[model samples]
Target chain A: MGEAIVVTSGKGGVGKTTTSANVGTALALLGKKVCMVDTDIGLRNLDVVMGLENRIIYDLIDVAEGRCRLNQALVKDKRFDELYMLPAAQTKDKNDISPEQVRKIIEDLKPDFDYVIIDCPAGIEQGFRNAIAGADQAIVVTTPENAAVRDADRVIGLLEKTQIAPPKLVINRIRPSMLRNGDMLEVDDICQVLAIDLIGIVPDDEVVIKAANQGEPTVMNPNSRAAIAYRNVARRILGETVPLMHLDEKSGVFRRVRKFLGMG
Target chain B: MNGKSSITIKGVKEGLVFLLDDQCDFVTLLDELHAKLDKHEQQLAGPLVHVYVKLGARQLDEEDKERIRAIIRKQGNFLVQTIESDPVAEEAADYASYRLHTVAAMVRSGQTLEHDGHLLLLGDVNPGGTVRCTGDIYIMGALRGTAHAGCAGHEEAIIAASLMKPTQLRIADIISRPPDEWASAEPWMEYAYLADGAMQMDKLTHLHHSRNKVLQAKGV
Candidate 1:
């Protein structure tokens, strides 16, 4: 059976849905049969992020409530032959579905796909529980802010209590300029607080927002810094070792110059 | 003689000692005690005399103690100061407060690991994570979260961590200054404690000077 991964962050507005969409897209692009499940229910955004919102005729609640079969509810991503999207119900709240139902849906999808990426809702409530119920692995997304890091730490603690493998952290929305100016919390600091393995670091790039506005994942644009980070995270999920991208803009030029001189 | 009393009364310096026979039935003992007090009513009527009742091997519940107290109250000028049993009840298993509990797991944010006694954590206390103990708390890793040592009103409790950057530190009832005031990059394990009702911080090595009991060991 394929593994199911949940992208969750305890606090809201921490890019969990964005990470889920991009990572799922990257996995599909890497020749893995990937299925993205939106467990956010009433507050679903994964469909919109994947640009599959208009194509969704049946959703998670429809399949859960036996109104439609699992395959019928899965919306195919026309861009990638291997990618699929299981949109959440817009009318039903998180409490409408139970963890057992979510687990069953994930289990059903796992055998048909190489990877199941679940987009979790914010907060440690019923929605979060439903999202993680069937996940074999977890990705905790957080920003560099103290509040986001704090919430990420809380979510990590909760994730540890679950059967999922120790959740890897994805530090999203990192601003290298703010970091250099000492105005933002460093990646090291966030890692120190959460005490988890770092899976990826996506910098604060305007491209992510622009792509989202167009209902497209940033990973579609290979030149975007955030896109590279998400792709690296997907490769890491496939057990590939990729060096972290140089986030310091000035240091990249300095290091390139030093390498070119070769001490001459 | 078969008519012999099962209760004996003696006068000590502080009070009157009533030695109740353990072998007799409780009802018989109470009857004999009442009779004895009634017999000495005239002699016991002087000043307000303290009465101490000793139950040799008898376990008296609260109701039984109240019954005995009521009987003594019936006797004029007698105040029941103490009602004790020879076999002391085992103290509740509060040994947890004295024992050191070792946990080898990260205390992540929004999670609280509480111990009745001292806590020795092998992993980090991440921000928003809390580790509370009735006694001292020792962490082998970073403590970026909140550590409340002596949570159960133990003012002498101390919280020590390898990396002492915590969101908040609480010892007993005293909370530390805001996280800004405690921001330090000193590359030494540090500890926080209450001194004179105020929070104090110092290097871990100097802990022995303030709390010698922490290092002291008693053996047979």
Candidate 2:
């Protein structure tokens, strides 16, 4: 059976859709047939991120409502033969979809794909519930800001109640330079607060924004640090043992040195 | 009152209150009533047996009512008592004491929930929403939000739900996270409680088993 994963972050603008697009693409690149579903409904962005916005004819709502067949609504990505995108309906709101309907759709799609990645909408509402309805696992994306971490923490708590097992954490938009200067929250700090397995630690990168604007997820670019991190996260999802990159090695050394030198 | 086996338990109220107990098999009760009517056939020469077993005109909660109804169903339509008031009063009292308390329509940012009692959330507690309750936290729906139970440090506090996932969890400081490799998609009713100074989860497969056993053993 295919793995149905929801990329959710209770807080808005925390790179959930971005992570979904990239990770879905990455997983597809790993030879896993992947389908990315945009569950945001009215405020859909996953299609745009995957550069498949203009190609969308039938959306998720259309398929769920039986306006179109599931296969017909699935928009194939130009980048990978194994990758498909199911755009959300911009006209219909979150209420247009039900959890049962979403679960049915996922069940229908599971046998055909290796991974069903859902780009969950911001906020814990009808949209969030729909995205998670049939998800086998969840990836909670969050930034390092207090509000983002706090929101991530809350989402984690919510996921626990689902009895869906613990959702993994993906800390995106991290600034290693800020961490070096003691201005950013470290990965360990986030892990301590969230108390979940760290799957992805994406550094703040302009490449990601540029790629998103171009309708291409940064994971396609092998040079981008954030892209590499996302790919690593995808590998982890596939049960690979990839080691975490040292984003703040220089600053970590300085801190150790400072602690070693107890005297002036 | 005029019937042979009619036990009339009275109050200021109108009609008879039927007492249902688990002491004898329901067949035995009905058979005894039938036999009593047969013995007094001359005194009460009615074709049908009218054996009214009245317990009392007592109010009960929904749970108690369900229990009573289950027993009544097992007895199967022989014993009939006219209740002066609706049996619903007991349901009202029971529900009033433990009606699920759903939080505000939205659990917004920077808000913390510290409830001494059960927390029934109708909506989601978006990320950054913190809840610390002394009793169980029941999110009627999804709980991808953070919740900490046993805040007063009660280890007995259970965190249960239809869908469960939390970022950070502490059941009386016995901190444990979900298995890193667990990504199963099943709608399960799971409870987390402190076991051996650690958090443990168990499937709530026996909803009525525990209470039923206790009641049966207590001879209630």
Give i-RMS (Å) per prediction. Answer: 1.1, 5.8
How does residue B202 of candidate 2 score in lDDT?
Answer: 67
- Compared with the true structure, model 2 gives a TM-score of 0.56
**Per-candidate clashes, comma-separated:** 0, 34
A1-264: candidate 2 lDDT, tens digit per residue: 898999999999989989999999999888999999999988999998888988989998999889999999999999899999888999999998899999999999999999999999998878888999999999999998988887777677678779576899999988888887888887887776576799989888777898999998899887677788899999999999999977766445434433544421
Residue B177 in model 1: lDDT: 59
Where does model 2 exceed 4 Å of error? Answer: A249-264, B1-220
Q: What is the fnat score of candidate 2? A: 0.18
Reference-based TM-score of each model: 0.77, 0.56
Q: Provide per-model DockQ scores.
A: 0.59, 0.10
State the RMSD for candidate 1.
Answer: 12.5
Which residue pairs come into collision in candidate 1? none
